[model samples]
Target chain A: MTIKQIERLRKGAITLLMLAISILFLLPFLWMLSASFKIEADVFTYPIQWIPAKWHIIENYKEVWIGKFPFYKYYWNTVKVTVLTTVTSAFVSALAAYGFSKINFAASKYLFIIVLATYMIPHQAILVPQFILYRQIGFFDSHLGLILLSSFSVLGTFMLRQFFMGVHNEYIESAKIDGAGHWRIFWQIAFPLVRPAVATYAILRFIWTWNDYQNPLIFLRTDKLYTIQLAMQKFTTINGEFYSLIMAAAVSAILPLLIVFIIGQKSVIEGIALGGVKG
Target chain B: MQKLETAAEAPKAKHISKRSSLQKKETIAGLLFVGPMLIGVTVLTFIPIIATFLLSLADWNFIAGFKDIKWVGFDNYERLLQDDGFMKSLKNNAYFLLTVPIYLAISMLLAILIDKHVYMKSYFKVAYFMPYISSIVAVAIVWQVLFHPSAGPVNQLLISFGIDNPPKWIADPKYALPSLMMISIWISIGFNLIVYIAGLQSIPKDLYEAADIDGANAWHKFKSITFPQLSSTSFFLLVTGIISTFKIFDLIAILTKGGPISSTSMLVWHLYDTAFVNLKIGYASSMAVILFACVMLITVLQWLGQKKWVNY
Candidate 1:
């Protein structure tokens, strides 16, 4: 073969290999999706059915969504907690980020370092104490509790601070000269300039709170107040025998985030790339 | 004379007031903006840490009021030495650290391949990253279905290959931890892959072109250029992946419940089981303290090591 022809052939070969491997890496998701639409008997049946023979998409989804357990309540609970936490956390973290990045105060520097240091301490370390504190404050088991607990994150503050720093000090100073106060300056100038970063952190927070298992597992007690993670835990442990139901429930849990992942693929992916920090 | 003097002093007085007001506003604004976070940090993070440390030194089961507490300094720490479960959990966490290399290697390979050849990168990125973004509860449940003992596809595939009596994955005492390790690695690959891709793309193209002109092989080019360039990213992934995987809890909680004899019981899971499930709050607090110290120590070591070893 000619050298140029050899290069073409190698390129083709690499493309083919990448395609096959991508599919293989995607097998778990494919399996989950396929299983989500399958009946109970066909779910684990031999030869690995890639597509269900008798598609039970509606039946399976309906069963998981509103059937005996009615997962919608937990879904709403999750939605409420996620939205509240995301907005509040974004707002609160942005405020802190602005203070740290824009304000010239000695304590801001020391305080930023403390917040950054707190990021290193795993949530589990303080988990027990927080649990006790939450109980004491009557914040446990309520969606409000979840909202309050996750309302601000050091990671969010830190990530947004990096963006806040990118905003020109000129803008804030100019705004200040116009008699804009601190709140007005942060609100009108700094916050909007870093809106995209704030949104990124908020979107990430939404996903994180939605996916959080540890907090709800500990704090949430009553089933009525359980988040999706807590609800899914209960659902799966009791109903794991029904692969179709569990898979369907799994589908319900992931479909929204998957949609978000697909639609906001660039932002979400870029968000991680920005800091090398995963939500 | 009084009017002339007052007129001159008015501007100076206004300038001084403006400067003072600006300074005052700065301090107050700084305090105002960072106030919520300061409170959160103190209330949620700082206090809890002190409370956890103090709780570790005490004997409390979390059932009684403040009066029920019994101070027992160093006793919990002493018990941790003899605690076989805690040791096993640490061992499991150490075992879990093995995923870091696997994650790094796979991420590097896939990242390089996609960076070089893949025309449609987002498809592969989202496909691999779906599990990472999805709820662990959802992932666990789906994995549970996949790891089902008798009829699961994994066993069915193995059975087709004629290896009968395939170990029941999550249920098998021997394979449970390893199986969970596999899942954690799978979940980790997506994030690391994206990070690795970002790292690879940051490398200047001329380095590769020069290598091509020199007739250097792919392996050599990667070793000298790509690998060295990726050291910082790899170091980051290494530190983070190890720390995160060591805290593996949700998957184990949903899939195996630390399984057939605590095989999959990790440090975080052990802490959960001790404090929450078993209600040994003080003991679990000690475990928490140990876990915190270990994470901090490792992070400090890695940060120090980066100065010497990592490129950036």
Candidate 2:
């Protein structure tokens, strides 16, 4: 074969190999989507039917929505926590980033390193202590407590600080010369420049807070306060089988996140790539 | 008259200079900006880490409050050393550590393959990344269904091929940890792949051109050029991957709850169970400290080792 033919053959072989591997990655999700529509009994049927013989989409949706599980309530709880956490954390971190990156201060470098080091500590390492402190303060089981814990993000501070540092000093200097105070310079000059990074952090924080299971499981005991992840866990009972119902519940739990991700996926990917490259 | 005027102006200039000192004002503003985060970390993070150490020395259950505490000193650590559950968790964590490197290698290989093959690149990337985007709880549930022993698809496929018995996946003690590892690998591949692809793209084109002029074969070129350049990225993935795998709690919680005879129980899961279910806060705090030490040690080791391989 000619060199051109050899190159073509190599490319073709690779595409085929990639297609096979991609299918493996996608198989579970595709199975889940198919199984959600299968009849409860047929779900466990042999040979793992790629397509359900009978469609139970409406029934599954109804049961998952209103039957035994209060999935809607769980979804609402997740939404509330995620939104509150993401917005508040992003805003606070931006202000803090501005302070760290722009304003000259004694001990700023050492203090910023301290904040970054906090991120390195595994979150679970402090769980017991935080729980104790929260119980003492009477913040235990309160949505406000969960919101506060989620919103206090050192990673967001570090990421936004990097972005803020990238903002040209000329704008800030010009703003400062115009008699604008530090806050004004931050808000008017720095904030607009790092909007992409802000949005990126917000999306990431939202997904993380929404999907968080351990914190909610530990703090919130009431069924009314349960987030989607916690609610999904409640689907299985001891000595009981409800595979279809659980699958339906799982689907419902992931739907909102999937929607949010698909909407902001382009920016999210870019943000993640930027983060990796910059680091 | 000129000398007198100069002397008077000097005092005026000094006064203005003192008044215009922006450094002090800027410092105060900087502190004010970072004040909330500083206070938050001190109260919520730094204090708690120190508190964890102290709490590990006592025997205070939340039900009994602070008054019921007993200072046992190294007793909790001694108990942990002797505890079978703790040993099992440590063993399980080691198993996890072993499995993660294999997954990272597979992910890196796939990433390099995708990078080399230009056609349908974005499509393949998205497909592989779909699992990463899905919620772990959701993914775990889906896997549980797929791994069902009797009527599940996996067993059925095996039976069709003339095999009668199939191992219970999450339910089987022997297979439970492996099943969790498999799911973790699937979930993490996309993330590692993305990083690897970024690493691949960042490699300078001149290196490849030089290899081409040298009449280097693909394997030779990749070995000499690609692998050396991607070393830093690999180091990053290795450190982060090991750290993450050691903290494997969510999947275990959702799937097995460290069940089938504590086979899948990892350090974090054990910690959660002790603190929450048994309410042995002090004992659990000790486990957390050990976990912290292990992770810190691994990270420090990796940081030191990176000097040998990491170019930048």
Candidate 3:
């Protein structure tokens, strides 16, 4: 055989291996998706019902969505908190990034160093005082407080600043020569240039906020105020015996994230690429 | 207005004053732009951390309010040394660090294979990355069903393989933390793989070409060229991955809730349980401080250790 044929054969074997591994990696999620459509007795069937024989899809979903402990409220709560937190975090981080990177000032270096250092202090380490502080400030048990907890991210600021630093000084200078003020230059010239980086950060922030279980678990007391994560936990405990309903709840909780990922995967991959190269 | 005034003034004086004025404007703008984050960090992070330290020194139930804060000198720390739960949690967190190297190795191998030989790279990337992006609550719940003692698919597969008695994962105390670690490794390999693949792509082709010219095989080239070039990415993933292990709360909260026997209880979960569930604010604060110290120590050690191996 030619060397090219041998190479092709090797590639074919490796591709098949990767396909098998990927299927194994996806099996749990596929099972979850499949189980959501199955009747209760069919869920635990051996050999695994890769596809449901008797579909209870509508009934299962309806039970999760409109039954006791309805998911729509949690969904709405999660969407509100995730959107607000992402926008606030992305904008705040971008503004800080631009300040640190583009607008030179005496305290820029020191202030940025301070912010970077704070990123090392784990959030878990500070939750105690934050809880007390929130209680004192009347922010405890409130979604507004939950939003504020993650809105000003040191990591986000630091990540975005790396991208902002890539914005050439010449552009900002030329804009300055055109009589554009700092704010005007930032909004028009600097920000637009780094908009893709900001979008990447925003998508990440959205995912983080959406998946956040700890904050909602800690801060939210009212059932009405619970985020999707909290709701998922609650639903599972209440429906522990009902596998089909639990699977439906799990799917409902994860479906939005899947949608977000599908739409924004290009940005997500770029973000990861940037992170890799930054190292 | 400043530019007009500077134009009308003496040339040398105007140049100096204009420079200072521009500097002043820039400083003001910089401060304004950074104001929200600066305040937010100060109010939310800076104050809370300092308060965490201070609160750790005093015994106070949050429900009892400010009037009840009684200063206890080193008592919480002393008690922490004797607390079995805290000790167990500390041990579990250290054990959980095993997952970092576990996933890193698997991801590095997968990354190499996929980068050079696989078809539909993005298809595999997305499939693996899905779990990383999925809510831990949902992931935990799904795994709960999969890990069911008898009827679960995992054990069912094991049964078919002729192991009649597969370990009861997540339900058995001995297997709970290990099960959590397994889930963690599964969730994180994709992110690590994505990062590793990117690192692999960035490796210069000339080095490989030079190695090929020198009659170097794949393993030799990988060892001398690829691995060293990817060291920085590895370091990055290592630090982030270890830090994330310390923050493994969601899975524990969902799957084990610190377990049938506190076997899966890590520092964060113990801290949460102490502070929220038991309402031992000061006790939990001490745990938090220990958590802070441990994270700081590990990070510093990694930083000091990196100079020996990390290329960048």
- Model 2 bad stretches (over 4 Å): A238-240, A277-279, B1-21
- Model 2: per-residue lDDT, tens digit, B128-211? 777767778888888887888776787788889888778888889989888888888888888888888888889999999998
Best by lDDT: 3
Q: Which is superior by TM-score, 2 or 3?
A: 3
Model 3, runs deviating above 4 Å: A276-279, B1-14
For candidate 3, lDDT tens digit of each residue in B19-93? 999899999999999999999999999999998898899898888878998999789999999999999999999
- Give stretches of model 1 more than 4 Å off: A1-5, B1-18
**Top candidate, metric DockQ:** 1
User: What order do candidates take by DockQ, descending?
Assistant: 1, 3, 2
For candidate 2, the docking band is medium
Q: Which of candidates 1 and 2 reaches a greater lDDT?
A: 1
TM-score of model 3 (first chain only): 0.96
DockQ of each: 0.76, 0.67, 0.74
True contacts kept of 1: 0.78
